[model samples]
Target: MHGSFPRLDIGPLSEYREDHFMIARFSDYVHEHQSLVFPHRHSFYHLVLFTEGSGRHTIDFHHFQAEPDQIYFMIPGQVHTWDFEAGMEGYVVNFSDSFFTSFLLQPEYLDTFSFFDQDSSNNVLKISENVRERIGQLFEELLAQNARATHWRDDMVRVLLLQIFLIIEQSDAVDRRKSAAKGKNATVRNFIRLIDKHYDKVRLPGQYADMLNVTPNHLNALCKEHMGMQAGELIRNRIVLEAKRLLINLDLTVSEIAYRLNFNDNSYFTKFFRKETGMTPEDFRKSPAI
Candidate 1:
């Protein structure tokens, strides 16, 4: 069985104070935190911009090829691991969930970025050649700002980081502006956030609709329009995703996972998993990590 990996906090991963923010060159970060090569979870926001590399990595079980100018984002609680060539180099940034809370009036501002949407499929982005250098430059500025304790150092760091995010969001090849506008819809965004918080206990779309002060049909229509799926599918997908994440940790038995997921019994959970993912929990656990 695969060994269970750790859920790392920012304090343990860096030599600096636990000031809720850390920045370093990718090579230095890797050298200092070699154990991160193993599958692990982070209790903070994590992002890496690969300036040069050739290998592969995983974000919440989704596989991605590591390449120069390719950047990936991981939110709190997502699992991540990387395997790269000897000459790999880049920048890595880790910040606590509250990193922007006090700085921004709207604490959920980061969620507006597609890359930070918590969907593994949207976690990675290709930095176009035009803005690649500028992105790297911003990262360099971040490294510098983090090293000094000058006046307003943290706010300067925040401004630079947001600059990098805005650049990526503006130039992303995916043409996310339209979808991003849709995502800003308070009802839809709130629905997704609710699902993330209560997926285990609240399993029904109708219940979520009730909480959101909307009808089930209206909620389903909104999800279908923006997320390309019905409301119920959104809930089920979150549950299946949690099952897969929990399955990666071999120490937990199927029954325990089922209980954690609010499933009544192991057999019922197996049936639901197979229906959604076409594999039993044990089967998924045994299969190779991709």
Candidate 2:
């Protein structure tokens, strides 16, 4: 069991240089009582390598069981929470988005990797013992170089980081090829990715369809055919998922949450929420599963 921490806000990027990389071993302080890290979002990407313990990692509306020898990559701007049992060991590698775009953003390079694609649903990357040893060594080298102030230290750190991503790229190629062959249409996949990226602001199906250069009807038909649900259903699910997350994870009032979700009238939001969920917002918030 893990106790929740106060909501943590990781601030936006103040600098844009890709010269520095932050690597930390979380095992030093995270224990049973300290198992929960506050929900936070960062401007840079994070690669978390979990070596032991079991818990749930919640990112946006998605939740996954965390286990040993697993790697979780979180892109920029995704709010996430880490809940773990005692005695967890891991390396957290943090780098600016510019670092990736500068070095690995080529079409051929990106096409060779699946993990970086916004359309790919493969969030958790499993690591083999041999690969883990190699990654661990790279991380140690990064930490050592980052601690030094030599003129060539930054260059060395950047090179090492690139090497790490290159290795991941090779391993992720097979997965990407499989995903591409799955043959989901680009429009639907792009729409889903847009929703994941901008759902907080863009909630209307017509608006999304317009952005994708397709009619609302066509978009709805495609989603229903491929996902077994209409585009409207997908939008509503995202909204409700965010609502549930806010209600359960924060101390915000129902009315406040309704307003934040863009409901002009709090009562209307409550009614709509209950109509879909079969429970009032307040009652749903009080449920034990939360």
**How many clashes in each structure?**
0, 0
Q: List the residue pairs that clash in candidate 1.
A: none
TM-scores for all candidates?
0.94, 0.69
lDDT of each: 0.84, 0.68
Per-model root-mean-square deviation over C-alphas:
2.2, 5.0
The lowest-lDDT stretch of 10 consecutive residues in candidate 1 is 8-17
Model 1 gets an lDDT of 0.84
Off by over 4 Å in 2: 1-5, 8-20, 29-36, 53-57, 60-65, 104-122, 128-130, 144-178, 181-186, 196-198, 221-229, 275-278
Q: Which parts of model 1 have CA positions greater than 4 angstroms off?
A: 1-11, 14-17, 181-184
Assess the local accuracy of residue 216 in candidate 2 as a C-alpha lDDT between 0 and 100: 97
Please write out the lDDT profile of model 1 over residues 1-290, one tens digit for every residue: 36634432334564332668998889888887776776777778889998886899998888999998889998888877788878889998988888898999998888888788667888888998889889888999998888898989999999999999888888844456544744558898999899999999999999999999999999999988777889999999999988888877766789999999999999999999999998888888778863
